[model samples]
Target chain A: LSINQVNEMEYEDFISTFGNVVEHCSLFAAAIWSQRPFHGVKQLHKTFCDFIDTLPKLGKEGILRSHPDLAGRIAERGLLTTESTKEQLAAELNTLTPEEKANLTRLNEAYKTKFGFPFVICARDNKKAAILSGLEARLENETEKEVIQGVEEVKKIAFYRLLDILQHEEAEKLIGGW
Target chain B: LSINQVNEMEYEDFISTFGNVVEHCSLFAAAIWSQRPFHGVKQLHKTFCDFIDTLPKLGKEGILRSHPDLAGRIAERGLLTTESTKEQLAAELNTLTPEEKANLTRLNEAYKTKFGFPFVICARDNKKAAILSGLEARLENETEKEVIQGVEEVKKIAFYRLLDILQHEEAEKLIGGW
Candidate 1:
């Protein structure tokens, strides 16, 4: 979304869209969206705790669906920095590997059998190996706790990505001395 | 260090040691250590903003070195849990990597080539690949910046590890709740 569009968003609307980001992968999206208003990367970090404080609690199913599967060509893709549909297609279709394809299949089966939902992980700058590792390790966790932890991890990921996209030079300059 | 040793540290000693951790990493280590004798993790997290407020300037070199390379085996290896060793290690090896057999060769070479000090990272629950990745990444940074960033990274790693060791039950409880 453009800064102009973001500027037009009412506080409530801003909260809603950004909240969806957080609710999806509380750790990843929250980390990215947590830094708003075009500040440089430096001051961008200061806002994280504030964002954390305002975070809404996510439910198990909501958290489960937040992350996409790592199979296909998705693992090689980076975080989505724009609203273009083409970017999404390019990322997903070009990066899948044979191992990731097979692993994702097994993960789908296990996740469906255990929790009736697909496994989720906020996937920005994450490889298929990392995703598979996370998925396998999380399987050992109680469904309830894993859901919560997954949300936290997602938010963290979001907060970081948000900084990369939102922070501007002026913001960085203003906060640089701090 | 044991609770008893930590309990014995004067405020000055505490601050100095904590500052070293902050000097090492500017994120959670600085945030958590900025507040002392926190009643609980909740309090520590709650006052995260206040802690950030107390952060010193992030100089160029210092900021770059904030993240240390994680050592897979060294991270898994345990530290002496008493306060005496904690203080001594804190003073003497302000930035030392955890020992690992596989890393000894490279770690030695890297230290000799880059700086006069051994590589350091906060090695909690990290594996060899993760730590190696950190080392390789930091090696790309300029010497001055790498040291600063490395110290900060080490601080973050240590702070989390310290919290884990100190309030073992509480950390577990918090992890479960998350």
Candidate 2:
């Protein structure tokens, strides 16, 4: 939808449209619902991010942990959200060789054993090899370092997801002033 | 550290050691510090993840947004945290060909334009080709789908990072009961 159209949306309508952008955490949309009539997609995006930034540490970690593991049990049981399924597919994670799957499983277990949560990466932005190597390599970091890294990755994911919601060809043209 | 050592650590020592694991957000360590005398590494990891899960959404997103972009301006300025710098290097994002760099620049801009933040992937988990292709393909996703996908990736990054912190040989043996 056009930025102008978004700006005109009622609060509930706005939430309904943009609330799901950050996974099941519609609270982001709910929190920012009253700040409607965003100047454009940029403002809208900024508002959501800013709101998230303002949350306490515990809340932020919850959102970070809310995501599923890459090709972990959630994916195996076909329990991932639709978007996750597609993103994993794009990375070709669904077609792993047995060795690759075993490796991933090992990495996932190792990663979880250390970090207390599943390993997360934008699978669509990586091939399985990269993901596997990343899993193996990051296993050597300190806990403090890893937690920070995890959150940063989550933000990037959120940012891209927000863009997907806001940017269409026409909206991109308008936002880019094309 | 061994689960036994972790279990014996004073509250201050525990936070001091593990506090920075989640970036500037030390609350994870702080909140869980009192729940000390962890039975083992598995229990320790569980405590941390469980604490994170208990947080409200806003707090969770804050943690998610705390991370720096992979190979974005922060890295260009040489201001990424030590771990991030190493992780990006491991992925070889710092050594892009000029053409590849330009492509990355273009993709980054397009991605940020479409999304509100920089694209995030676990660089250490991907090759340049995978990163580039992942960036290129994800641009076609709808906003909600992308947001979910992005957060999922961030989670993977965090999971690996956590593993890095918790998975020392001793702890692994303890957790694995080997």
Candidate 3:
């Protein structure tokens, strides 16, 4: 839908479309739905980020903890959220070799043990090798630093999700209707 | 974990464990993390219900909308949240024959068209027949009445989910640490 369409969208429609832009943190979208008539997508993204930025450390960590691990149990069970499954597949996380999967499993656990939250990166923006190395690198950061980094990664994921919606909206416009 | 243990558990652990009790609304759990030291499971349940009760109309609808539809596209894609998947399967929604699926799909769409949010029942507590008839019956209600009923159904879902967690905690306690 266009920005004008979004501005005029009903509350329920606005949420169902963009609520998941911030992963499972639809509360971010719900809280800011009142700030309608967003000039464009960028301001909409900023509203979500600013709401997220206001949360305390524990709240931010909760957001990180909401993310499933890369090649983790949820993926193994084929039950990742639609957004997560797409992002993971985009990173070729599903194509990892047995050894790579095992390594990722190990590092994901270690990262959680170290920071008490799952390691989160924008899987759509990183390949398996980058994801593996990034996990190893992030495992060393302090919890506070990791929370900030993880939240930043969530925002990156959100940005891509928003863009995906925009592209689909454009395609829908061309196709006339669903 | 016991309420005692839960009372002392870290915020991240608390969320990761109980966050999905309200379907995908982890924000409910996150919003109440500070109100720790709940006397027991009932108290915790009340806390959640109270938090939910406080939400305004749109907010309540958002919670209802966050839930995936019964036997809907998300279930067909096998991407329903883990909690929802189990609940739907328990209701035997996954076992519907082609004709049954078609009937349910038609009714579900009719219900959604009549009321903005999907028809939500505590699927774990109701069989497919009940669900189908329930959908047919509820379609005639006013939207405001449906919203209240839907939110009440959500609370029932959350109640069962909490009890499942409590039972698991009991079993875990009996088995000792992993």
Candidate 4:
């Protein structure tokens, strides 16, 4: 949908459409709706960033915790949210071998044991190799720094999800006019 | 676990054990871990209450929205988080007739339409009758009043969840000492 279409949406429609733009935290969409008549998707993204930035450390950690582990239990069970599934598939997380999956799992467990939140990366921007290596390397960072990095990744993921909602093609516009 | 046990837990163990105390807003657990070595469950409960109180209106609404509707889709699909499944079953929501379920679905949609969040009640403290009647009456409330009331219910639910954690029987203590 176009930014004009977004700005014109009712609260419920806006939420249902853009809600998962931040994963399960539709509250971001719901909260930001009041700040609406956004200049464009970028303004809306900035608004969400501001809202997220204001959250306390615990709140940010909770947001991080809400995310499914990359190629972990939720993905294995086919229970990922629609957005996560698509992103993970794009990154080819669904195609890892058993040995590769075991390696990622070991690193993921270690990372969570250290930080108390899952390792979150913008999987859309990274293939399975990058994710595995990133998790292994970041496992050694101080929790404070790692938390900041993880949240930063969350923003990148949310940005992609936002683009997914806002992208409109010429053909789509023509179809929409029907 | 005893209050003493809760006080001494490492951060990861603490989050795993107590995170769901606020439904999906585990950040409450994650954040409050810093204020730890709580005097007792009551003190811990008080800490959570204070943390929640500090949230802005939007934050509280986001918290409320994280809850599943009583007798709603998650329940129908048997996908409730373990805590929710127990609470809803306690309220006998699982046994609702199809007509009753339809009635609740209608009221729930209306409630969300009005307030932009779900109708939340502490199901363990209420039967299906109370929930239905409460949702019906609360639907008439102004959005501001209802938000306050809904959050109040969330706190009550959280309190009960806290007790479930702290309540250890004498026999259980015997088993643990083994």
Please give the TM-score of chain B in predicted model 2.
0.75
- Cα lDDT for residue B34, candidate 3: 66
Alpha-carbon RMSD to native, per candidate: 21.0, 21.6, 8.8, 6.7
Docking class of 3: incorrect
Best by DockQ: 4
Candidate 4, residues A1-178: lDDT per residue as tens digits?
Answer: 7888888886657777877877666667766776768876667788888888988776787677767888887788898999999999999988899999999999988887888778999988899999888888899899899879988998888777777788556224433221
Docking class of 4: acceptable
Best candidate per TM-score, number?
A: 4
TM-score of each: 0.33, 0.48, 0.60, 0.67
Clashes of each: 44, 34, 0, 0
RMSD of 1: 21.0
Off by over 4 Å in 2: A170-178, B1-178
Which candidate do you rate higher for DockQ, 1 or 3? 3
At residue A174, candidate 4 shows an lDDT of 33
Which ten contiguous residues of candidate 1 chain B have the minimum total lDDT? B59-68
- Per-residue lDDT for A54-131 in model 1, tens only? 433322343344344444223345543342123224335245567666777787568646753456555553555666
Q: What is the lDDT of residue A61 in candidate 3?
A: 68
C-alpha RMSD over true interface residues, model 1: 16.0
Evaluate model 4: give its TM-score. 0.67
What are the per-residue Cα lDDT tens digits for candidate 3 across B65-147? Answer: 77787888888889888888889989998789999999999998888777767889989779999998998999999998998
In CAPRI terms, where does candidate 2 land? incorrect
Candidate 1, after superposition: displacement of residue B176 in Å? 46
Each prediction's DockQ? 0.01, 0.02, 0.14, 0.25
Per-residue lDDT of B1-178 in model 1, one digit per residue for the tens? 4445554554324433443333232233322432356666555444443443333322222232222222222233543333323432443333445544356447635753674334555444344455556666766677657556654544354445446545676676666342
Q: lDDT order of candidates, best first?
A: 4, 3, 2, 1
